[model samples]
Target: MNMERRGFPVWSIVAIVLIILGAITAGLSIETVPEGSRGVVTKWGKVTGRTLGPGMNFLNPIGVDVISVNVRTRKFEQIEEAATKDQQDVQATVVVAYHPEPQRVGQIYTDHGLDYEAKLVTPGVTESIKVATAHYSAEQLVTQRAQASDEISKIITAKLAANGIIADSVNLINYQFSADYTKAIEDKVAAEQLAKTEEMRVRIVTAQAEQAVVAAKGEAEAIALMAKALADAPDVLKLKQIEMMREKWDGIMPRVVGADGMSLLMTTGE
Candidate 1:
């Protein structure tokens, strides 16, 4: 009876041990890739070049590991400093949207590992922005912001593509300049406005001066014309004298005469 009981107990222990090993093996062999993610398979601490899509992935349980990488669009912001073409220091906040090429996730893992943003995207963005900023002056950066962003996006796209990342967009969010530079720009705008105002005032004064000169010329011309008309006709002077005599003489003539016996015209009251 003791022998039979011992034999049954040993079989039971063996079964239990086998079950545990099977469970452990299944746990290591089966990997579930979450939605919007890809699994990178590595064997013996080396990339196996096998990429698993979303769902259950089965692999050799021995000497195998799987890493999940998100393939969805993600954004990261970076504040970087660069010098403009005119040697002005500008601080820019840049936002980058990107995603791992789903098919190339394995390559990305091979090249940059899971920390793709830090190793791959970040350096590309920094270099591209610096290159682009160096092509524009401080004022051109503000005025031609769209062109600058496009150039940055193009440069970064090419850079990240070489490393298995797809760059969706690169945007320049904000720009910060030194206080002295900002104040200088403000002062320049103010001076330009003041100059425009002064120019308008000068134009108005010149117009008024021209009008005054025309008015004076017209008055002088009218007076000269009247003097010329009188000088051209001697009969006009004689007519003026006759009209004055008629106005002063009444119906009666003067009886007193001078020594030469010439009659003097006079009014009745005189």
Candidate 2:
């Protein structure tokens, strides 16, 4: 019985040692905060008011909660269908680039929680798209889509900044209209193209007519210049007459047929 009692004390000491070792192990447990991320730690259901950065971080094993917020840039795509100023239904697909301010991440988490995508980002994007698009007509939306996208981006950035989120840029990925509207736009574009083609053809014909007049003027001026030159130099006229005679005669003697009893003979090389 004494031996058994002594063994009991030893077992008690072993169990105590194991318990102490377990407690130490638990206390030594640490988490790593990745680069470009901030760790928010809460103690006993209250935020600790301190943010942890990259590397191993210690926290209370029992009552502390550590939440990691990524400081890197993130992209979100938002799609919405809304009515334009002209009451035309359009679908807008937008992509937004954003990043949480590293210094403000803790506050953002506290205020927005983990589900900021549903609570803040999406709503902001949708609202901005709807509001900005509402100011433009369907034709304007199609033709000046870039301007509409810029306006929407500006509004979204401003709104997100107000809520502690930093938006880098918003891009309109695609804008689609109803099939009937698309067909109408295509037809209108075709008509405009046809009108432009007709205008171009008319311009071409007018240009051709002007060219013809200019060419005729040039020919008349050339003829007057030739006459002036020939009048100034009578030898030029004789040389031209000799060239014409050589071309008209083939070195044959001239033959004359008279019908009015008057005969005139012209000899070659005369």
Winning candidate number (lDDT) = 1
Please give, for residues 59-159, the per-residue lDDT of candidate 1 as tens digits: 77788888899999999799989999999999989898999999999988887788999999899889988998999988777768898888877988999
Residue 90, candidate 2: C-alpha displacement in angstroms: 1.3
Find the 10 residues in a row with the least total lDDT in model 1: 1-10
Q: After superposition, how far is residue 30 of candidate 1 from its true place, in Å?
A: 2.8
| Cα lDDT for residue 197, candidate 2 | 100
lDDT score, candidate 1, position 81: 91
How many pairs of residues collide in each model? 0, 0
Residue 118 in model 1: lDDT: 95
Worst 10 residues of 2 by lDDT: 1-10
Model 2, span 219-265: residue lDDT tens: 99999999999999999999999899799978877768789877678
TM-score of structure candidate 1: 0.61
Report the alpha-carbon TM-score of model 2 versus the true structure: 0.69
Candidate 1, lDDT over the whole model:
0.87
lDDT of each: 0.87, 0.85
